[model samples]
Target: MSCSEDPTCQELLDHIYELVDADEDAIDERSRALLAAHAAVCPSCRDAVDAERHVRELLRRCCGESVHAPAALRVRVVSMTTRVRRTE
Candidate 1:
């Protein structure tokens, strides 16, 4: 059954973002372990989790490799952000 119809699957999907995030603080180790245990027993949940990880890896490999923004653009953005206006 799909996650859309399964409560357990839906719960797993709900935490998918935390499951896929690289930041350790995104989810506790206990929670991650619990999800892993569930996914291990559920083929549908396992496939979903794998797909999310694959997509995240693809995005990181493609977009995360971009060079820093040009210095001119950075300067313009900083100038705009630092501009102050009088309230009076």
Candidate 2:
């Protein structure tokens, strides 16, 4: 069951980040369907989606294919930051 009768442009835009990170999370099927349908007819949204996809791809390629840090590295970084304070 979809929350919205049809995904509005605003709704799609708001969730665009989720769409870009689609593989990272299980976005609902209804929302995914709506995004696909809307992008087909909405040039603005299609362009935005394309740009977001491109940026994500580039980042993946440049960052060695994983957007997230490896678990071991993350643990080390977190421990090191325990005493560091953010200045900005």
Candidate 3:
């Protein structure tokens, strides 16, 4: 089944954040299937997800270790993110 037959565009985008955040554990099997189906048809979303994965891989290779984000930086990021609303 394709995205249209299963997940709608909005549904795919909603789950895409988990993919972009590299939160594989957070994504359920259903979301993964929907994403795979969407990727088969939507080249733009597929390209974007691929790019995000590549960037994450590059960061991992460059750092070779996870760095703890400062509490203040985290707070600032959270505050900024909260100030903005997701647009469809």
Candidate 4:
């Protein structure tokens, strides 16, 4: 099944950045484990998570270790995720 058709994929996408980011507490452990398990079995989800990590690493390298997301960006991200969840 394609990623687009998989609810797990939607979950992955919705939390992709959190899953790959350095913040370990961004998600609860159980939810994180579920996402990790799904990514392990779903190549598409794995790739998406990997890509997010890669981008994060690239940003850190280019912008320094102190690289941080702007507050506005965080707001927008939360808004986007909320909209996605509402649609589902």
Which candidate wins on TM-score? Answer: 4
Give the poorly placed runs of model 1, Cα more than 4 Å off.
1-7, 66-88
lDDT of 2 at 77: 79
List where candidate 4 sits over 4 angstroms from the true fold: 1-7, 22-25, 67-88
The per-residue C-alpha lDDT of model 4 at residue 19 equals: 68
Residues 18-64 of candidate 3 have per-residue lDDT tens digits of 75664555566666776767867888778867877798788888887
Alpha-carbon local distance difference test for all models: 0.69, 0.72, 0.67, 0.74
Clashing pairs in 1: none
lDDT of 2: 0.72
Task: Judging by lDDT against the true structure, name the best candidate.
Answer: 4
User: Judged by lDDT relative to the true structure, which candidate is superior, 2 or 4?
Assistant: 4
Residue pairs with colliding backbones in model 3 are: none
lDDT of 2 by residue, 10-41 (tens): 77786776676763343677777777788789
Candidate with the larger TM-score of 1 and 3: 1
lDDT for each residue of candidate 4 in 1-88, tens digit (9 for 90 to 100): 1123334787788777666763465666666777788999999998888888888778889999877789999899979977886797
lDDT at 41 for candidate 2? 92
Candidate that beats the other on TM-score, 1 or 2, i.e. the better one: 2
Q: Write the per-residue lDDT of candidate 1 for residues 17-56, one digit (tens) a residue.
A: 6776633655677677777778889999999989998997
- Clash totals for all models, in order? 0, 0, 0, 0
Model 1 scores a C-alpha lDDT of 0.69
